[model samples]
Target: MSTQPRTAVVIGGGITGLATAALLAREGLEVTVLEKQPETGGRAGSWETGGFRFDTGPSWYLMPEVFDHFFRLLGTSAAEQLQLVKLDPGYRVLFEGQTGPVDIAATREENIALFDSLEPGAGQRLEEYLESSEEVYAMAKKRFLYSTFASFLPLLRPDVLRRGPRLARLLLEPLSSFVAKRFTDPRIRQILGYPAVFLGSSPFTTPSMYHLMSRLDLADGVLYPMGGFHRIVSVIGDLAQAEGARVITGAEVTSIRTEVSGRKTRATGVQYRSPDGTLESLDADLVVSAADLHHTETELLPLELQTYPEKYWQRRVPGPGGLLLHLGVQGTLPQLQHHTLLFTEDWKANFEKIFGKDTSVPDPASLYVCRPSATDPDAAPEGHENLFVLVPVPSDPSLGAGGIDGAGDPRIEKMADAVIAQISSWAGIPDLAERIIIRRTVGPQDFVTDLNSWRGTLLGPAHILKQSAFFRGSNASRKVDGLLYAGGSTLPGIGLPMCLISAELILKRLRGDTGTEALPEPAPWSATADSRPESAGRAAGGDAKPLPAEPSSGDGA
Candidate 1:
């Protein structure tokens, strides 16, 4: 509100923090991003070892429109900074006892044909499902995803009222129920129901409202960046700095200092440990925490300023943690695709184990295997392959807290070995284990130490009915007047797109711009009907090593 430069300190150099710092700097505020890791990107970060590069967290670029819209806001486009390659068969879903895996194609006709061959009338029904999903995606983008829950007025809007019935059904109806009502085939149901894992819920429990994920993956199709997933991070960081935002990686904010005036307690600055282990402090007019929400509230802010205590978080269900294995093998594994999902025959049992109170990992577990070398040869040395495997594991208090130190835990190594062996058998590579030249594992302990993730959850909180929308953590602090929250833990919830949207929502609230128009404007290229990207090939990886946080680990990949 002042003509002079208002300094703002943003904790965490993750996607949300970087985006927020850029936007705020563009608005003439002096913004500084404080990231604990040596590099930014949080879970979306990447690391390289033994000439093999691996994206630490998210690899699938499902929501292309979201990324494009973000760059457009920076006065540029993704095409300018990143060469995105569209995966023709978006991904492969393999089932136990099946000789051949089902490839989900980018084109509707190909997918329809694949569905029809498996089940009669299923092809047409698949189209119907996606059609409904498309409508839901559009509606959600307008009325929910891009909007914040700062007021109750938006719920009374004309468009929201008009779709009240449809919204109610989707909100109340389970995804499994919705799919079963339409298709009789079990395989068809499994295929349609798989996207629920992306939001950290089982199809049997997740609301049908989340079926919009199908539109993002099946209809819009999945994509890969030119040089692994970290390219997006490098590009965004450049743009943020170009916009006049200063970045200080390896500076971990230990405490958010506050000043009290009358009854108001406002955040004034922060004390952080610099990369060299020296203590330092930075004064600011406002503090935006894009770090782990729990860590920010319980550790960074004082006890009195804490709004959601440990008990508050304990009651809310958290998304799954991950058992990750990054491998550099001696030879190529032609049986695998760039993006592969190995589904369990008894998927519900796997879900039970994940959500169950027991600390046991799932048996015959569902897993996601990402072979970066499948698309980019440079990801590995000649004739070798770089594989990143992820299995959904429990992140309850019973599990070990995730971090670099916990990465070498014997239990984690044992679990990783079992999962890798299972993947080898499924991929028809009997000697896969023998070919592994380099290996690393990340488990619950790694998540806790790296990102200070509550319960070591990779995707923040579970997107259950009670935790959805306004029920989720607030971006604006309830007690700390000048502090705000961002990232997957806060409003709009989970996924990289949601992180970007969270930044925009926080910016609007800070600027007092409280209208539907506050949402991100569509990129000029994205407005076209046939904006499907061409398949471009390139090398993937860099010298950066894995960071503290990991990607969206709860998603069934």
Candidate 2:
């Protein structure tokens, strides 16, 4: 290796890719980020039409701590970077057969009361559940979420060893069964289990370990970064450039260039097609593929260079895809909150259909709806609403892609029409379809064509126990030197927070650091400045500002 200055090339400019570029640049490595889309953000991107701005990806802003940690690493904070609105009654739930929607208040008391109203004595059970959820979350945030898992010994520490039995039980029990054991009212059970969908699995399949997700919303409250998640993307993109990293959009990485020398194989750089229709190559000391993991392995590298080859993926289960709708409504929606979840009466059957051996879209689907205009006025024009809807379905690319107007694939448009009618009737908005002046549909095939998503899975691999935490795909390429991975497809599971942590994992792997804790707040970072992050550390005392604690918080869409 020629040593002048270390350089890194990051593939895909989605949230993880962008975050990786900024972190790598801050580490003093020259960095370049390539994004295939015209814009960055990947699944977290947004769309604008009819004077309305609809967030296309990741509508919820859960895990405030993760957001803060990522920004602090970049010498900033979420509060300093984005306009966040802490939603009151974090979100509302509309269970089938219910006369009206039940609000999930940020305060424990209100939430307890809401649970009690649904089923008597359920209030006390909720308190116990949240307390347990908090405990599990505290344990997970440290040992698992930030873990490199390079050593199983760190998890053998006394504190963790003591919880071994409990941890095993958590891993063994299904989240749906766990909730059902506590709350008899199906609505209460569904409320507790619904978070699994956001994690890209059905509750019945997801282990009880993920009950920690409930602590985010039912306890902490929900936040929406104004201007949508794309704003966060732009902020990270800007930070990368500010740190001297080059972010190139409309650049499609065709292949990761590699060479075999002596006995070892290593990634030297990548070849990509430029916007002007020319093939370009960039040489780097290291390369990080933050694109879809399966695509990177199966398509970007030769069979011999592939780490997780096609045969490896054949045994894996893909996450659920989405039937998404972005609609600009003509008038206000009184029945819906900023975040609304309409649960189907047959929650078990609904999930079965979505994640079954022969998967299909659920007819009486348990769907999520986001009306951003309720929180951010700028989301819509006057007297208008920007509604983002998601109904989980099979991750089969054959289901077909989405389109504008009523022009999507027949199967996709049919689902959209049915969902529109369902939501209109359930929410008591008879004219909902007619009031939709602008509509956009995104189906499973959209994920395939637009994102190179394996099996059109919207969130990568499902968070089943086997596919989670230590068992998840490794971030570093085992056979290729100077190659790494980040994003949902790798270790630590799904969602925006996990994506950010995946980037941190890349940083750790590069530094040969195996400690499983958030890196300390580095003293003012700069491009080409490779000073050790001031340690001893922010956990004890540092001049870094305190992380903001909001309405005790949460978002999933």
Candidate 3:
């Protein structure tokens, strides 16, 4: 080992980036994080308005194990640093034209009992399905999630190959198909498939293996920090600082520096514009980019230094985007739950409009509304409520065509009115529009500007077979030797847990931990394979393929 310590410069201070920096610093490496935003958390950032605290992105905290493991790796637990409360009824769903809402409680028995009430025999089916899902989750944690796939041999292990048939079955069936097969009720299917929407894909196309989300949801339970998700970043930032990592926010990286040698074009550092608009250069031994894959690959690095061609992006399926609304109600909402999904009558047709035809809005729209104040009273002032509403919209190129202009867009106002009206009707809360004390809206255009997301996709790429695993943006960049990737867009796909796992996998790869315990290998499925040509450019325009019928969905509630 060299006498000098390893120095790493992390680009982006999002959850994955901060996790990576903190982990690296704990490993005895000198680390520095550069964040373009004024603060950390990236999409999971938080803000305060009129004394109400709201997590701007990622309201639900799922997969507490991921966070626990991360903190444990640094010789601590989140409980010691921050107060975490597990939600009882994880979330509630209000189906279109339904009289009562569906509550997803924390306890497995309660969840089963609730399901049993909806559909006779559903409780037993749910138990069986969860058991299977638990197995898959266990396998994923050991094999696919933790290991780096630089070589094929590790995945080809005997035990993993033995379970290839089961994995293959999961890859071939969609979450909808899987849930339908397991439970006879449409309501159960809807409940099981609800999480997929969070993944930026529909249950009709997402894989069945993603149903493991339900198992993870009930088994691990959903959690929230006292101050919201941003507290996660603050705690991690504190830990990083304690570990001697320098964090510099409001530093916009302009370009990456690399050596001339063709074989060893390692990242030297980055040239960035400071918060004051002054240009400065910082040097490092390695660079980790936690920004969106498109921005990091297409814009930040020099063209000649790029690894994959333009054709790669063309063949890959990018994730979806939407309009986000943060509202502060003047009075308390009696019936509102911590989390709620208001569905439209035509779910399939709505998806087709967004993903298939690339339309601007769904005819009958479905939305996710989160009111954290319901569970945590401190989230809002006494007798007041805080709400975060999200409507899935097409992340098409035309999102900025006069539909979103300085928060005064007529379309946005119309959509917000529609949402509030629907909520009022469902909960019997009269004059919801009149109860609004404060409001903030972020449309698809805002996602593009603030997060640098391609086509304003909230998540990175669609978790289709062709865009997952080894096929996704390589963890280690093809062009830059010392650069690696972690977060939603990279391997392991979208969501907080997956992104955290991505960070761990990339760090292990960077530290040359390739020979550690091998993970289980997924069975060969044509849909899961990477078929795009190397060096695919972003300029090539093509529609994404329909999502695969595999077993994967979005993150937890």
lDDT scores of the candidates, listed in order? 0.78, 0.84, 0.73
lDDT of 2: 0.84
In the range 278-394, model 2's lDDT, one tens digit per residue, is 999999889999999999999998898888999999988888999999899998997899999999998889888878887778898999999989989988999999999998988
Whichever of 1 and 3 has more lDDT, that candidate is 1
1-557 per-residue lDDT for model 1 (tens digits): 22233778889888888888777776667778888877788888776777788888888887777777777776677788788888877888889878888888987778888888998888898899889999988888777776667666766789889999998899889898998998886677888888877787678788888888888777778888878877777777766776667788778899999888787888888999998999999998889998889898988877778998877887988888888888889988878889999988887888888877665688779989999898887688898999988888887544553223235767777777788889988878999989998887887777787788888886888887878877786688878777888889987898888888888877777776555534555435454535633211001111222333322221110
**For candidate 2, what is the TM-score?**
0.93
Better of 1 and 2 by TM-score: 2
Give me the displacement of residue 306 in model 3, in angstroms: 1.7
Arrange candidates by TM-score, highest first: which order? 2, 1, 3
Return the clash pairs for model 2, or none.
219-552, 220-552, 220-553, 221-553, 221-554, 222-554
| Per-residue lDDT over 518-557 for candidate 3, one digit per residue giving the tens place of the 0 to 100 score | 3223232243325422111111212211211110111110
Q: Number of clashes in every candidate structure?
A: 11, 6, 21
* Candidate 3 lDDT (Cα, 0 to 1): 0.73
TM-score of each: 0.91, 0.93, 0.89
Highest-scoring model, TM-score = 2
lDDT of 1: 0.78
